[model samples]
Target: MRARLPDIAPAGSPATAPRTFLRAALAIAVLLAACSGEPDPATTPARDPDASAEGQAGPIISIRSDPETSAVPAWRAPDVPVDAGNLAQRKQEAAAALEADELFGEADDAIPLYLALREHAPADADVATGLERALGAVLQHGDAALAAIDDDRAALRRAQEIAAVAREVAPEREAVVEYLARVERADAAQQANRSGERALNARKIVVAGGKGAVAHFREALRLRPGDARAMQGLAAAESALIRQAELAANQDDYAAAEDWLAKAAKVRPDMDTAADARERIARQRASRVGNLRDLGLAALTREDLDAARRHLATLLRIAPAGDPAAVELRRQIELASHYGLFRPGQAFTEALDRGGRGPEMVVIPHGAFRMGAADDEADARDSERPSRNIRFDRGLAVSRNEITVGEFRRFVTATGYEARATRRGHSTVYDERSGSLVRRSGVDWRSDYAGKPAGDQLPVVHVSAQDAAAYAEWLSEQTGHEYRLPSEAEFEYMLRAGSQSRFPWGDGAPPAGAGNFTGALDESPGGRHWRNAFKGYGDDAWGPARVGSYSANAYRLHDLAGNVSEWVADCWHDSYRRAPVDGQAWINPGCADKVVRGGSWASSPEQTRSAWRLGSDRDTTNARVGFRVVRQI
Candidate 1:
């Protein structure tokens, strides 16, 4: 069920470029957060154990697209007080402890002490008060920082929606900025662990980190000023328009406020926050005498007396001058005297109710990339002949890495899923030195490789399409969500992540860290390197390497192009000419040939192309063929 290919790094492989390393490092940074600070036991939030991976909180992500619970009023929790003397004493004690290698308790303990000081300190206090205040802010509202991330993620989804609507319109920057900034921010936030001030630095990197995320967004508009993502980002920055509207309203600049709010509403009408802003604009407009008359007339025409009454009450707030319309304004005011102002915050109260985890899935953005073989790419086969352009939809969640052996085992134990190759079948285990294949004895999911002990983080191999499907179904049932083999399109979309290059990484073979390829193994000695290519006895170890044993793709998806061939949901189609344009698995009622993707560890370079497509019977199984599951959005 679980298998590991050997790691054989080649000697003197080129060192990875620093910029690329930083970029890759930023993308995977989230997973590293847990290991940074000591887990705090003093202030623990009640976390749901059955929470989905996307929604789980462990110093990183806290909210999902839909929160399972309603939002609690930002309640003020109980606080303990401390005097200036005690505070100073504690700081000195903490400094001494840090000198003695006891920082574990500092970040965790310092938070509460600082929070108490903030609650009781003078408003104008400086120096020590300021320092403790900042530290407390980081600790006490760490959740807010976490929630800001949630908002940033929400803004991304909103941007995608607008992009869909404006597909035909000129570019919008607000949406683009939010979308790019989010990916860069989350990626940096996730990786800020290597350095001591990473969390603080994460905020700074959002100011431009990954591969010029901010720069590309800006330049796209420069190149084709109407590009969507770029315009979206600009729109996001100008979001201050809404705040300006509120300021106008406070200054009784009703007309200007209305104009500004109307623009805000039109810009992103579907967003929840925008709706709230619109309600405020309505209330502000109602307070004007002339506006009240207009509202009353409009309400009367619609026969909504309650709305007319509310408008009139607001009209009387500032008495109108002695003009001809004064009598009418008073009449409207009297009629609307009992009316109440629209409540802005009510809509979001249950908003959290509708919330659980936002998407509970990561969004792998869309783009075009080559998906086939390359020169010097070994293991050429008929199915992998030509590379082609593969376009993916804007947002999809590819597994952050290959489904680890440990994760796979959890599925097997829970569903009792069986591997078909392990069931009354045989597979050829290639011998690198002899250049010969030996039919390995005995097979079945549970019985094959019984004596071999390998890591649970390795890929699960020897699985048929049916086996993969069954496992997916089992996972779905257990999780109360749909889980199944990714459709051929979905698999390609994920493998490509956001790039259109030949491999999951880019136009050419990825650098050694990008994957566990033959060249990579030839570069490293002593330590294990994923034997990506077959050069002879020493080139490839001829086995599945650990999942994520090598480098990850642009989206941090591991083993996407190699390590093992994965089963996809669709039946075999020689060409994508008639493939589904909407990114679904192409299923035919009578089709018996299943699609398999990503070359296996045994496969040479040529087989790993993005467009390489292979067909196998539904019942066929082999050590090289495995699977990764996908959740429909």
Candidate 2:
């Protein structure tokens, strides 16, 4: 006799039916042991032939009540009946069904015909050979059907029918038991898939206590590892979680939205879907926070401080910590209450009441920096000794470039103010022909470095410190903002552009695009070059280029360290004695000389150092001196 194979129980089903076990034990003790009939042609007969009566009810789950046998499945009969006539006729009919390839199913199959004759003629050669052929054929069909079910779930029903016939023919056979197991697994996976769909439709994605679409999908994966249908259900569940995150973000509940995204990532760690969803949610959150920031800024602009505070508080709760927009809005609230509202690095032009705009200015954030060079610095001067820290608590705005000819022309034309050079009728200009700076009678604000009519775009070089202040005063009157030269400390800070290096660029040779410094390669109109200039460095011009001829520094202030040395508001001091630490201009009654900061086109490499400073007479005007304005905000 063939050793019996164990039965497969459904998940959560009892390992054995206790009540059925006791009843079966009593029946076995009362019944007499029967003799085996025509044994299987090639193997032992499957299940007791008498069990067919129980099979008439339907295909039932085999009970594993007896451990020794471990199997009992009396399957339902095939749908189509074969002839139950004389032995020869039955054999002929079974042969015909086999020829038709109807092995075991609803159609007229040979397995059913052989089964009908097996009871009475178990010893016959034809029945034995015919029965063995039918059993093997039916087992092959069940194998193919089970394999098909994995790819096409619709084939599951056919697989189940094949399993039923295999059970009726030989439930205890090893091949039959394996086929049944495959079908059951497919069935369990399908059920799991259905449960996931139902949970998803009910919006039970990622519920607490492991009971939702996530749970159901996980169960499906356990039932059939790597099943395509199970994987698809998981993807759907993950999508549901992502959608929830997106919705939460839209509602401005960013905390909850992040939680949803994290859960989605857990569900599908192998996929980029969760990562993409995270970015999408973050963008939505940014949009929502941005909206709040705009509302806060608008309210602040309208002078509604209370409303602006409320909006800012709401934005802070939703936006990530240290959000730039939220910080800007907060700055606006504070600045609007006292001074003008502006963001650092923000560029704008002041609108004059006279129906024109002032020079383009970039907002500067207030901070503290060391004002002078360290003691070990190369070529450090006594004027830059004893470096002191300077702090500007209030934000200010500085013109992006030196006031151009056209810009100063507007002030002069509007105010009819005569600059000191124009009044004197004599100002110093660079003599390119002689490679010298000479005082020319016609040199003034309208003159270029060579004492010619300057282009509107080029910086006006022949303006004195007094002239710049006069223009700043006129600008203040026109725009209703306090416009003046940057303080000595502020000018140094702007020139450094947040650097402590030897030069504004760095300690090394000026890289390409480091601005219009004195370069050995520089050629004047007369082919003149500096004897003590940076080798291999040239901007191809001997005179100052247009106001913004070079790239701006980190502060977006152009030409702060190149083109020309600009004047500051602070009076000239011999050294660092009693200097102002608050970034205010160190002025005294009747001061004659003012502080100048930055490198000029004729300056040597050491002179371009950020720490370099020059003190000039208040009435000084030259081809290499220009000025930009600063506005108090």
Candidate 3:
């Protein structure tokens, strides 16, 4: 019961959507002081992370996206102060240390000794002046170390050690606090530069969450805006995006090219380079379009409509608005399925809108042909009298074979439509036990001639005319094209396929291995052979074979004359009194019966004639009947 064809491709969803993120922690923090009068350099409102010079304090990014986590060390954990005893002796010792130029190394150094004297004498200007000179020397060493961070990482570590000593001797000095923060920022900037270079070398150009080369390079700039290496890395990232844009433009995907260029603008923020790329794309677009048009037209000439359609899709994406060349190419491709471009007997298929494709079809040429049997034709019925000259001005395509179980299963599954036999729970099937046709229970479109489960390649039977029309309608919707049961006249003409003989072969008897018809040598599954049939022909088939099992007709159609009788669009009439002049369906609204054409394996010699016809109830379902469709160009 769950017999759906596995032709459709499964749908998919995006794995990850790109998004924006606000950097946190050590990613460039800037704090400003009160917007009042101009503040002096000591109270210069130090930013949280950056420093213009190693001697000054500012705010900037760090090694990580987080603001608080970085390579910059913390303010030296609270150091012990110099011992403040023996005030006069301490001052004299401090003076001697300063004169000897032993700044602040040991306990008896100039700055430490001065700090001990200051604690005893609150208004000691001499101690304060000596401490300032010692502080100046510390700053000179720290500033020089900060500048050397890019060349020598050990220098940055040395700068931090010196700043810690200055803070310990001159605890309340603003210059010491600023100098320490500047050194930390320079260290963070160096780490960011190194990280960016690693990512760039591995080709991690752009990541969604600020982990790629572009993000690292930008962070380095935020920490130290003048870093030459970081600046160069960022430029390289922008250039990569531009190269991608050019590649997409070459493939005729202008929308994707523009998308790449937009990303480049965000990375580099330059207008002129982006504009130049756009101009180059525009100049190349005309030539690309010309090449596509030429290739598409050539494909049309060769009847490679699929390749032609592909080129047309590319033209739609890259061509300028309302371009005449694009419009003309579209028209030419649309008209390719005609007499001028398409040859008779050429096979093709149409792509469905959702997935897969319609049944294989053979193009039929446009010409006038005799529709019905003549008066002198032997064994011709009254219904075939007064044969008229029917003309087909428009080229048409017919299914190469009868609709198979696999093809019909797709229609029933897509629409959840039940066939008439399934609704009735019974259909006429061949009873092998009695060697005769009998109504069987639970037999529907899924069963074969003997009421067994059918193979997918076997022609679908036990379906009413209404069910066949429903399948055709579903095909039309899936393919975005018109498809319906062929007209009775058209069916007969294709069955003959340039043959004027009684049968599709010639006047007398069928050729060897002609078709699946009633033959004297044919045997049924029950070991019974045909009682009345061709003298010595045996097609080796007791029931319907897989579609396209035998040789094709003159028009490259399979199983037309002998396989199964097929439903057509026309309603049954007694004679050709008021038949349609054009090869269109003849219908009386709410008619009781539908026209059936072609012969079956159980047919006698007369029944196997190309001019054979049958009129069955519209809702009748049987194993001996199937259908084929016609597609309009």
Candidate 4:
């Protein structure tokens, strides 16, 4: 094979070299065919590897053997150093492209291109114009998107995206900032509206109406003014409250009905239901007034004064004060109370005594007391022994004051009756010369203890028991009432009042000016007979000063202690062994000595005790004796 290769060589070349050359030629042909499918490496533009790595697009390459016959794929150049003219031309082309497609929100496509162009051509007007136009297009598209979408969250997201682009592109655009704020407010308003709707649906019906719904609706209106749905919800809530009020009223729950009605009125005062409810309530109250009036009248007819008063008061509260029935009921109640039966502390004047011009009389309540005196009483007489318990079965009226000289004179003048003392022309009087009491002729009921003229206000002393009885009988006839002297028990009871002491005032010495007892007054010129006056006691009066010369007892009767001795209905008894337990007068058919009670100015302190008693001849008269009258009701 080596000898055959040497014969193929025409020159003096080696045969192995020819074979190597042919092998190299074959490799070149394979390489040329591989490159023929792609553009020629020498004719193709080179790409900067650093520019490509920096997020820049690959450079646009153009290779053409015939300019009109070949087409090149469109491409974006990698970001690179460029002249001002070329950068300007590129920015204008980009802006024109954005204008054509309106891909204004395509920041990644357009914004970076303009910024890269601006880096190369910092003062290029076309670059500046393109950048501004791109930002404007972005904001305008955002506004359009916000307007297109009905959802607030969607609009807000779109607006935020646009705002981000604008901030990077043109951060000083006032309209973009304003549009963002508007979107935020719109979002808040929409959120509030949703919350308000939920609250309105979730509200509970209560006595105070739908307060929750009202608050929510109001807030909704604040965020979104004049919201028709919120207004409608509020109206519905008010209507619901009014309906609740109506139901309560139908059930006769007037208080609850009123509460609901008030709530409705607060929401809408012009609701017709509230007005209608008020009218119905008025009718119901009017009917109740009628029922109450009937009850009051029935009670009055039954003589239940307290129950009648209660019902009538209720009626007045329900009915108007000017109602005729209420006025008449009040009048009836007053009339009944005025004519009621005798009770303790009740006071009235005799109608027959010149039409309520008679002496005032107080009703004494029926009670029991230990009559007479204790056995250890210092000055108690034998007639006051064996203190008995006497009870008054019925209340009686007694004169508030003793029979005055003026009152007795009226009885005498009307009846032309002569008193026993006047007929006798002699009475017991105080004789200053002898400093003792003595019988003085010409001294009668009209004379004082010293034989001086007595005033009409002073008590009519020197009256015998028979005279006192005669006067009481005359007054009874004049007044058409039963009047008589108090029983011995009644006399002592009235004198003691509620006291259990020696004196009504207390067991101590009588206070100065307590009553007209035998005191310093007797030391006066015409009062020398009171030499045994109680020590440390003075009333400034020798004898009776007036009918009420002393303070009254608890029963409000005056001069019951020491102004004068009083005549009682009982005949003189030695002891309480046979005393009447019913407080009636104890009298024997033939007993001529009547009982006298209470002490006079001429008596000592011991004699002035409540239980002290004395016996007096029925026809005998004395200056120190007087009487009070009692009447049966």
Candidate 5:
């Protein structure tokens, strides 16, 4: 019999129910069981015809719940309602909730429920097929479940083993179809949950969680269209790039810094950080050129003229004429002219020029003189002994006194070039009483002399050849004249002053009043001896005196031989034999040294001869070294 019980007891027994007008359901299994011993349809009950067919029929028993145990006791349809053709129709509705609740825990638990509800279900082909398919899927997994379990475990716990296997295997293979209805409910809930601010913040955090934050932000923007947080995070990343650039700048890694700054600028055109980065890039380029200037100076001073040319060339290429260092930059160019460093497209502007401050005009005239040392000269090295004749077609204009700080200020104000300051070199001092030179620090143009006026017309001592050239070029542009470094020939020509004598005065020792020299004062039986004026104070105290304190040369040039060593235009050739006879700077593509002539006030008398030669670094500007300019005739 098939029965519907809404309140059945748990697994041990069936439940009773109050059913005043209850619907009944009959299963096909129950019908088959009840008819197993009953009539054969084909024989048509022949014996029953003799006994009256209706009276011979068995009693119509209806199964219903027991009053006390609520078990399936008897189910019945009233006698007037016994219609065999409509039995299936009446059976369906009563079986539904009963079937739904009973099969809650098996591998194919719902299949039995569907079977009980089948007859009552609506007449729709789609629903029928769906129900059949559901039952079939459960059955398939049920078979797989049986196979996956060991025979021993299946026998011991068959029902539990089936459920465990179904949970593990069936979901993986057919999760989409099995959970189609459930997923719809879940998806709706997920959409609503994602709309809140907390969800938004969580998304932002996830997007920036790792090394790929920038890329993640981009992807997140695509997924959740119009996300403002992503856009702002991208902007922050750009700022981070700017900070990286700043770090590079601090380390002087300019190339890397520029690359980083460029990215920042591209990401945010209107950002102030980008603007600052661009400005810093410009400053870095300028600084790079200037530092090269210092290196060029050092190389020139070391007589490495080739290295000097290379450095100076790089400097000019990196910095345009409008740069702040341009004036001094032009001087480097002019000085480099003597080294063949300039190209055809370059512009030649005269650098800074100041007229001689003293009364003497010290005109180193236009003529050739013997430029190397004599055989018998004391302390003559091989590079100096083979002195030869050097010619000059034009003379040089020289200062009677050292050019002073006050004079250089005018050039700086007009041209905006930086004036370098460094420790003083041992060359600028003069001693009169002991006829000895005295050298001291704090004697360069940048440092203040302890007891001096620091006048503009006082010659600029401690000046390097390149420094002199820079000053000359700057002066030239300001005055509209072609002021340049005097050639070695011109410097000696002016120092000799029309005399063929071994010295400007004579072949004898230098006169005490004529120039500053190295000797003891008054021959006072070893009162005080003079060494280099740069060494320390003595009869001739240490450091430079005021410009033009001594008598002028015959050319009226003051302090030429004694006070400072002069810079010349020629690249140092070691000898004069192969030098230009036509009074031009000897420029070879390979030469890297420079020549200094007319020994300083710190040099000995024999060292001050017209033919005496001193070579110095082109880049060095010490306390006693300076220059004079000459215009092309």
Candidate 6:
């Protein structure tokens, strides 16, 4: 019963088979279309061009597929005119989303959406207002970012971005542009400050009063108008320069001090320190002038003429050109040095002869002294009494020692003049065998008392007063100056020098080797009968030694006390009752005797006293007599 029901219809009925086949094909197509979610090609209608033109239905709108979401069927919809209500609803939805997400400023979100809505509905107040709000939000966000950035480049970038947005959104707005400009100025000011600080720290600002630093500081100020730090730095640099100038001045480096001071003046011409430093420098220079003047004057006083000249020259250089004291000091130095005799504590010669040597002279400065001897002086002769003040108004050149034999010989040779000893052909000499003075026919100025040959250095003796006068006159003629025998007063004045005692040394017994006196030859076999020997003193010589063999007196005059008696210009008088107070020779034409001062090698200690005086005939020649010349100044 289950198997045979449909068997008779199955084998050959054509109409029934065709109907079944058709039904199965139609159901397969419907199932495939539904599963694929695609409209049947037959049901898909063609776009209507007339409808699109009439705005009844626009061209079909094809929606693009989103790769991030599930795939949907790509369908085309007719672009129908949007409904006002629907568009309004869509705008409200987008505005609500923008508000909810607070994406009003976000360019990627609400800003683009608002822009699109504005394009569609250009007059929509809400869209315009929303777009404005979004733009403002963008500017605010950029500003916040810029403020948060520390790096200058980062800040600039942020500022530029804000400015760009503002230009695009509201081209007339200047807030962002102004902010960028301020940032630029601030950056420039900071850079200038840094550079200036570097230079200042390195001491490159050598000029005072901020001259070197001013340019940098000014630039910084221009960028950021009033900078206190820059002002302070400029002042400090100026102060440093002033201090350096002061230090140089303190060290007496006037040249360097002046240089630095000039720079300081350029820096701050009105600064108080600059004024003070200038004053101090002036005072220092003045003090130096005074110090130099003092040194030069002191040297002059000590007779150090060369040293005086050097110091005075330096003073003139440093002193003001017209300073009166400096001028006067220079004049004084010149006067002192005129004679070329400025050495102190030494003796020198002048007036060179053919032999290149002349009278050894001692410089005597103009001075006042008491001539002759004191009334109470022991052993002083009557002629030396009546002491009186005598002032030499001018400096004089006096011989340092008695004229020597060689010196006289040169004078005689040059003048070819006959001396009294050679003309007389005989002179008085000490006869050692007889121990008495005698006139010998062969003896002359060339022989000593003992008949020993006279050396060049021995004092020339046995010359008459006229012979000495002739010699002095010849010397004066040769040298073109007045050379003469010293007056009696001048002789005693020089012999005493500055001494007030009976003797030049002191009022004591003559010291051993004081001079060549009678005692000096006491032990000699031929000098026993000399009669006037100093009992306690001896010089170890029987006759005159070298002209300067003894110690010099204060005036550097040698052989003043002994060696030989010297002829003077005064006419012999019994006493000083009519003596002239002035240092002049008391001359009388009728006088037969000339005054002789000092003593001789044959004289006793009493006779060697500075004020002791004697007289001799004008033509007399003695073995114990010699003469020295004096030049009038």
lDDT of each: 0.47, 0.73, 0.73, 0.64, 0.48, 0.63
Q: What would the per-residue lDDT of candidate 3 be over residues 1-633, giving only the tens digit for each residue?
A: 111111111122111100111122122211111121212334432221111112222221222232223343333322224444566677777777776655555567666666666675657898888778767776776676566544433455556666767677665778888887786666666567667655544445576678777788788778777765567667665655565566667656777777777766777775466677778877778888888877787787798889988998888778988875676567667666655655555689988776888899998755667777777888999988668878877778999999999999988887899999999899999988888899999999999988999999999999999999999998888888899999998998899886777888887767776778888888887799988898988889998888888888877899898778899999999887789988788999999899989988888888888887889999999889999999887
- TM-score for every candidate vs. truth? 0.39, 0.59, 0.48, 0.47, 0.37, 0.47
lDDT ranking of the models: 2, 3, 4, 6, 5, 1
Q: Which ranges of candidate 5 are over 4 A from the true structure?
A: 1-364, 420-444, 448-457, 522-528, 532-542, 588-592
RMSD of each: 32.1, 16.8, 21.7, 35.7, 33.1, 38.1
lDDT value, candidate 5, whole model: 0.48
Off by over 4 Å in 1: 1-361, 366-394, 431-435, 446-453, 506-509, 520-542
Better of 3 and 4 by TM-score: 3
By summed lDDT, the worst window of 10 consecutive residues in model 3 runs over 13-22
What is the C-alpha lDDT profile of model 6 across 498-593, one tens digit per residue? 677888788876676666776733566543645666566767777788988888876678888889999999899888786777788999997889
lDDT of 2 by residue, 375-407 (tens): 899988999878988877877899999889999
- lDDT score of model 6? 0.63
Worst 10 residues of 2 by lDDT: 25-34
Candidate 2 vs candidate 6: the lDDT winner is 2
Clashing pairs in 2: none
Which residue pairs collide in model 4, if any?
A: none
Task: Give candidate 3's error at residue 613 in angstroms.
Answer: 0.8
Q: Write the per-residue lDDT of candidate 4 for residues 342-400, one digit (tens) a residue.
A: 54555777755543355678876556688777777677777778888887666678888
